[model samples]
Target: MPDDPLPTHAGPFALGTFRAGRAPFPGLVTGARVRDLSDLVPSVRALVEDWDSRLPRLTALAARTDGTWHDLPDLDVLAPIEPGQILQSGANYRKHVVDLVAAEKESLHGATPEDARADAERMMDERIRSGVPYVFLGSPRAMCGPYDDIVLPALGEQHDWELELALVIGKAGRNIAEADAYDHVAAYTVCNDLTTRDRLYRPDLKAIGTDWFTAKNADTFLPTGPFLVPAAFVGDPGDLRITLRHNGIVRQDESTKDMIFDIPRLIAYVSTTTTLRPGDLLLTGSPAGNGAHWGVFLKPGDLIEAEITGLGQQRNTVRSSQA
Candidate 1:
């Protein structure tokens, strides 16, 4: 059986900071390190045109199972790239959002059962009106590498975690077709879309319709790393499992199969609006089990672990910035 044809064509590697004499901090890892394509554009293009012939080598180097992995300690894990832009979508799961609203009502003001139901309905209606794929932008400065401590803003108290799968753009393209969208992808990674819920819901209560920017774009809010698994290794980006654990407690558990706007569709949709360039990043949205609705915010000394099936895991400790 031709070696089972290799479950995936490429990787199962870790993204980390390489230093002179320390362990590479596993920042993020995905089934495929497609993001590298952006860093090596010509090579990726060549391979894409002839994947059957070139995939094997890429897979071999990525696998690197010789147990001789080097330890480089002096390096600091930083954002994978200084991406040209970062785009994120919301409400991609109906059930998740429904559960979110219900949980929110129960935590806020101790609302009655009838009020909770009413609040959930209103929240869903608002989310729908915001659009099927609610989108937001995160500042590049907000990006951080795995193991880097996240500093919560002093003004914010409702800090939350949103575990998600992120896409790294391989080639620069505009008005890309859904059929060709995957071709533009270089790799995938895990993203923790950290936010401040109080600020996010503030405008909602005021009926002013805020854009969710303040809630998301805080310093070091986006923690991404471990490794960038090449695209050839990931046969289907939408079928993998994603899970999040806070201090060893499973909080979010679901499969990418639940995404309303699949990877291909999301790439195409974003391309129609803006040109996606090499090194650009798109966060495919988080599933339902985020900390915002659960009244579970990260406190000092807390650790978070985000993982995707086949992709490696990201572990980080949370610390507060003292005044």
Candidate 2:
């Protein structure tokens, strides 16, 4: 058992993983300095694999006043954890879904924008009643540093950003119930799910709606983790504020409360398909005001900042791909 208590300051303390150089190591960010937990837990993956047993030791290390404290700014924050698999929720936010539906209606059906939006809201309500969360597989290779540069693929002209709240699974469980889903969560992190908007659908195969593989899963596409705010620290996952800023302009500003299927539901639904294990990421979908809705898309040298309350923040710069 940890003799020391969890640290608290201006905000909730978070678990982070960083590499001063080549080797990745677990760290604890307690508002001021990042306490290196390498002596206790080597990597975030190691900690997650044995989270239940290692948490006390982690707490003990975090609580200690004496240790190798690195200035937070000096540390090179990694992706926090290299998840076993990434399970992303699609069209999970009600407002975002409605926005897409409304846009589709206006363009495809020639409905008035206002009427289209209203009708979409009605459709969303029906979905809430009869729908289950949409889940998709994401390549862990898409992961990159939170403050790293985003290399936009030239093939995909409409590069877009989706800021999401990513849940890190703690315990291994299959067929998890909605009520017990939270028990599987280890921590939370910010994930910018970059998409190639134009490549999202296969025009050749109109019947096949979305091509998630080509649209997503590019290297440096998923910007994750300035910190992994523990699930215990992030109270009421449904209430956190999610925001994204492109070139210093706020694009997506909404609450997690707008999610059509909350974390528990998403986890439960996904767990029904695959076992949720430690270090597995479950990305709750983005909020409204995506690049498509705004009639704007990412260009070279564009900067994106994404954040969720208590999860810390991520800053990504878009760069033209040489390939």
Candidate 3:
């Protein structure tokens, strides 16, 4: 057994779903011990849905050390919550987008790499000044356990990992204002949005931009949670550190401060199209450093370890599809 199965959060406790034998139930994790919350809530989603009322109760429960608790190694840890909807923010990281823009420009017939990068930086500044966040919808079916195996689909070879910070919505609201967006957030967790780079675009149809369905929605594509650290404990969502390691080597490392559009903007933007409800998730884009940056991709037997400050860690192994 590992010394610390669950990464340490800022708060004294966090919430997750776990199973010892028959059924998965909500658990309150503090240190190496997990107290089952099945009596209070059926699942973590249910706990999150009633976050406002249950938060104080959870805090009170966490204060006690005399509850019936289970060892972290004995239970099977599942994704913290099954979200009703997943809204993904794309290219919201300044350096990440600038790097992508520079690479693409260098590949095409254009100015020198330095010129391209300079232009990209200026573009990012302008975009931050006036543009809205680029958001997309993701399937809940893509979610898997934090320690689950990621099966590389047969359609692509360049499967990449993009570790991100995911926010769980606790309230129902549409057209939410940027000022009040954080009110909708219940908790935060770590998510690795694995993508098949080779199939990200349709070669036959250049007019149409991205093929997010084929590139992102593969089964076990999104590895989420070891625990859900409530927003109150998380402090500022804009300053967390996100780090990912591939086969024991660090691949992606950056701070949430790199985000061009913060959490509020992302939540407000997505809510304009769809209602932000309890148990919904919003992925606040990824920072610089990916497989595309290192020219490396995931393969069978490869191990990926992703973590965000105060959210928790994810340990996933990559495998090829049986098909």
Candidate 4:
């Protein structure tokens, strides 16, 4: 018999889901090993169901999560949970949106890049005072493991990466106020919301810009979760650094402090529109510096590594499916 396991004190444990043969199972990640939770929990959904209550038990179990010990790298770490509702925020970063607006103004109105940038910066300030955040829905099926290979679809040649800080909802509620928004958070994770740049807007329907489905719903587009760090451990969501590299070249490098709308406001706004349930994911938005900013795009065999402060890292290689 194995020696008795030690008891745990107060914990800020991180949890994740792993593949058990062909099925997915939840596990506790501690040190260099993962304590399998196959017998105790059915899925990550069980843990998210009532995170406030379940967290204590999970922390305790982390002391002696003795089902089967597996080396972290040897197991297949997958997205933590398959939430039906994935709410994604867009244009929430000041520098990013300003850059985009400036580019558009210069291209369409023939303004100097300097003038356009100034006007866009002014527009951002106006919006901050009066406008609301742009929120969109993403398909759960688009989600893939952080370390898994991201297969670039053949339909579009300009596939891009948008690394973001994502929040996992724990408490279920509707019309949650901004003051109480932080209470609804369970954990924080990193996500790369991949996009197809060519299909972003339809020329046929110029008035109705942005085909989110065509641009974002490709299989394996959203690379997520090597680990889900507990919310308590994450001091402030907006202070985290978001960084991404393409083929070892630094691309996106910015902090969440540039966000026009912080997590509390985003959560409050989203909750007012629809009920936010446990297990749902809310992406705060990508910061400045994307492929669009650098005039480059993802190609076949390109490796992308996206990381956010404390949430863990996502390393994915892009594969072209055209051939």
Candidate 5:
């Protein structure tokens, strides 16, 4: 007896279908449908509002049927969107910072010159220095759709995996205040921020810790999707659980509540420094259990799956790279 908006039929995940050619293909969410960027932004805004108002009903509908009840087409089967930009935060988790500090101490052997310089630079970056949110951009060319294979770069032996909850900006805004940060968000998606630890830790790399752009932004480094759960479906971005599995073994198990800086703070902080545009993605920092910290790196043929409560899960397989 829930009063949620019921779909006409069950499907794999509630997806937003866009008009492509003569037919509409499932692209974003279920029940709600849109065409492209022009259609998506405005519709997403309205959808979040609707979801906020009809939470009881929507929750009932989402809970009434498991996603598996419907025959979901292969997630990889959906056409892809050219996202405007992918922005991510670093050291936003207090525990992560503690771990990084410990690692630096151990690796530098009493603060090497390079380590000192890197720490100094970190203290200056807006995203890292302010004790507020720090943001970095990922190359659009690095994006891969859900279920795509993530290639393990042969150049590095210490690869790592981070499971992060990512927000898709729905509205364009500059200098947005923390009080109104949620208004700019369109939807939520799960992302695995894969990394090459050796490249990042290498002493010869000038950028070293300062250069997540290369260490984390390599090809296929950002694996996103399953479905962009419209913000309506997810009531509060900060009240959710994030879990990561490697080859069916749990690796990262934590919650967004553990974030040292929450979503609203992140949005307000980043927007004050840069214009956040529609299709721009913000990956809130990852929780503690990363593979590199645990000494277990991904190898070819390994499977990685990341999931967030309410939002769907993203799965990827590790492929051997010839390079």
Candidate 6:
């Protein structure tokens, strides 16, 4: 385990699921050490759902350096929390959408690259003014451990990586206001929303912009959580930096400040559509530098490393189903 000290505001603690020759159990991670919390809660999601009442006890336990703690490397880390619903935001980053439009200038009917970019920027500005977020449902079964290998299914060849910051909802609410959105967030975690570019659209149903189920929800596609850092530990959601490396080469590097619709707005907009419940995740979308932009897609045996400022890191290796 990396010896980097936990962030000061992190209260020297985070929550995750870990296995030690048995079924996974919720554990409290303090620095390079971990202590089982399974006695208190069955799973990390259960602890998060009752976070308001459990936080104080967990905090007290974190203060002690003595316990039946285990070295982080000795255990297998699993996806921290299993959310009841996964709400994903699409095209929420300004520069990411602009670059996507700019790169596909041929679709603009004789327009120059500059014209395509300008048009995309205008569209983003209009979107922000509309005061709504584009959110879609994600299948929870698609989630896997942050360190797990991404199995490249035989269905598509153009696999890609999209590192994002995911918000873990603690409080339940309906039609929530932007001002009160933060009150519902319990913690934040790192997530990589992997996609199969070739399956992004349906040939027969071109009227539908994207086929998310085919393109995204593949098994082991969504790599999430080395651990969950409490919201209090992360001061401002919009100020964090998101970075990803493909085969040890820096690819996606951008800040959350680039998001067109901020976190509060995303939560507020999502709540209006459906009730936001505890143990639910709201992914704030990926920034620029996806495979679509770099023109390099994931292949078997490739390695990906992703991280967000303050949050923990993820290191996943890619494998092909044929292997």
Name the candidate that leads on lDDT: 3
Estimate, for each residue in 1-323, the C-alpha lDDT of model 3 and write its tens digit.
23455567778899999989999888999887899988777888998888899999999999886656898888888999999999898998999999999888888957699999999999999999999999888999999998888999988899999999999999999999999998899999998998999999999999997899999999999999988999999988898999999999998899999999999888888988999889999999998889989999999999998888888788888888973
Q: Identify the leading candidate in terms of TM-score.
A: 3
Per-residue lDDT for 1-323 in model 4, tens only?
A: 01212111113567889875787788887755778887888877778877999888887877875578776756778987778489999988999999899999999999999999999999999998888889999999999998888998878778888999999999998999999999999988889999999999999999999899999999999988877788988887878888899999989899899999999999999998899999999999998878888889988889898788877777887887763
Query: Cα lDDT of all candidates, in order?
Result: 0.68, 0.85, 0.90, 0.85, 0.66, 0.88
Give the range where candidate 2 is weakest over 10 consecutive residues by summed lDDT: 1-10
Where does the lowest 10-residue lDDT sum fall in candidate 5? 1-10
Candidate 3 shows a clash count of 0
lDDT per residue (tens digit) for residues 70-144 in model 2: 877666777888889899989999988998999899999999999999999999999999889889999999999
Regions more than 4 Å wrong, model 3: 1-5, 65-67
Judged by lDDT against the true structure, how good is candidate 1? 0.68
- Runs with alpha carbons beyond 4 Å of true place in candidate 1: 1-17, 21-69, 72-76, 101-131, 201-208
Q: Compared to the true structure, candidate 5 yields what TM-score?
A: 0.73
TM-score of 6: 0.95
Candidates' RMSD to native = 7.2, 4.5, 1.6, 4.6, 7.9, 2.2
Off by over 4 Å in 6: 1-10, 65-67
Q: Which stretches of candidate 5 lie over 4 Å from their true place?
A: 1-28, 31-71, 74-81, 102-130, 205-209
314 in model 3: Cα distance from truth in Å? 0.9
The order by descending TM-score is 3, 6, 4, 2, 1, 5
* Stretches of model 2 off by over 4 angstroms after superposition: 1-12
Clashing pairs in 4: none
Candidate 2 is scored at a TM of 0.93
Residue 41 in model 4: lDDT: 81
Tens digit per residue, CA lDDT, model 1, 92-152: 7655876766767788868876788777777666755554566777888888876678888
RMSD (CA, Å), candidate 6 to true, equals 2.2
